[model samples]
Target: MIICGTNAGSPRCWMLVNDTVLTDVQGNGQIASASDISPPYPSQKSISLPSDGSLYSAMSSVTGHPGSIRRTFGSQKLLKTENVWLLNPQFAGAAIMPSTLKYKEEIYFFFSELNKTARVDEEPYRARIGRICTVDEGGIKALLADSWTTFMKARVMCGAGNTQQQYNNMKQAVVLTAQDKRAGVLYGLFSNAWGRTVICAYSIEDIDQAFSTSKLKGYSSPFVGSRPGMCVRKNSTTGGHNDIKNLGVIRYHPEIEDVIRPVGVAPLDLPTDDQITHAVADIVLAVNDEHYSVLYLGT
Candidate 1:
């Protein structure tokens, strides 16, 4: 039961190797072609870790490797492109970047826009997260026909006013990959063009609301005074990219937006002049008969 996880900062491909022929998958021995199927991909692209048979992978783009999702049975195989999910035009948050977590049967990628160019006068980067239900069956002809139908994103208000200028770049993120669902929290590292990073914790519930709720309409004009990416469900029969594009124009979620998030910047003692860099989070389960977990943060 060898499962291989290969990704180049983004995208993934999973393949299972048979028990009898572990010898067939070679390394520096220089076997020109083990078979027609195995040689097309460079061995370097593979992270070489066994898989759990789940469609999840993460890596840094600097590797410059390609990825795919393949399910193999003996000598037969099928390319499960339908299992793939991604964002279009990319979302902002080039400052912080994206992270992944599995909630229920779905997988989530927590990231923001690629480059937070101000659509409005001084608007900055906005934090965002998207999800793909492992169970999504895709669609028919023009629309849901691909493996990426359920993909969607929305704005996140972690810092001050939850506005653009407040937390422009979502610099780094740490997700609780092994905590209890209800007891889990997402710590997003955010910053601005001015060079400051703020880490905010979003509860499992609030994070779910941001992705599950319906989105607001698009902004016709910035002067409309409407904050984009409001998480409200709508009843329109519109199609694809508009669905995610609407995430940018969400009206607002008063109670859930700015008010319910972490109130202040993470209380770190970094020098005021230097911008913060990276973060890692751990969920420590309580000792004794406690029914909860505590997030231990180390700088």
Candidate 2:
């Protein structure tokens, strides 16, 4: 099956089942209900399909509506809709990278978000890493139905060394595997607000720790968002805990906040010429043998 979009060229992703009539594995009904399977808006097209169903990545809109990692079933029936981190439409946060990767049963999306920095004018954009599980069909039926319970994001600070002076924005993300065909590493292309491009790398372990560890605590806010961050779980009506303080709190074990802080940031190095440029056009990981692999990045 090929990955395709509802429109001609946009990255709104869907599984194109190359059956007799072209079916939509992600519920868009390849033959009869193309419109039903089409994405909700114009956004990124990071897509990955597991053995049975498909999951597509998208950037949340700035209109106060957070984007979701969604799975549809046969035209209007949505199986799950879990909120994703980053791609905030308000601050112009987005994951407009070249690819969305699904490797070793996990999904990865890299993008840039406008930071809430003290000096916002100097370093407005910060690159980030977001991830979710492959089989995740959202949260439990009661707490959250049909949405991811394990979705989270972290800031990806490349070469900053806890220095706040550096500014970075993620431009591209790609997944690489070994000749043995297992998820190996992730490479990201980033640029600063002042315009210097840098490439960084992350192992699966790096990503796993950032998410598996207990969430960090520093400051709190009323609008900090619920833990699991589900849209449909707006109120706790089933339990009859009609307390106003609930405020639709969907209890979650956060990984990194919307952005990964400087101290927790650790970016591995990958060899690259590294120059100031508009963007990295594309990237590829080719396996030389079971023991080695080569990363090809073109800016």
Best by TM-score: 2
Once model 1 is optimally superposed onto the true structure by TM-score, how far is the C-alpha of residue 284 displaced, in angstroms?
A: 2.3
Model 2, poorest ten-residue lDDT window? 90-99
lDDT minimum window of 10 residues, candidate 1? 28-37
Instruction: Please report the TM-score between candidate 2 and the true structure.
Output: 0.59
User: Candidate 2: how many backbone clashes?
Assistant: 11
Candidate 1 clashes: the total is: 19
Cα lDDT tens digits for candidate 2, 1-299: 54445576333443455454554444344222233234444453233333334434343444545544444432322333334334452211122211134322445566666566637356666676656544444443465554554455676667656665554766666655443333356666666666666656666445555555434333254434243322222222344443212223323333354334332254434465566343332333347534443555555
Runs of candidate 2 with Cα error greater than 4 angstroms are 6-51, 60-66, 73-104, 140-142, 165-167, 178-183, 216-290
lDDT of 1 at 225: 25
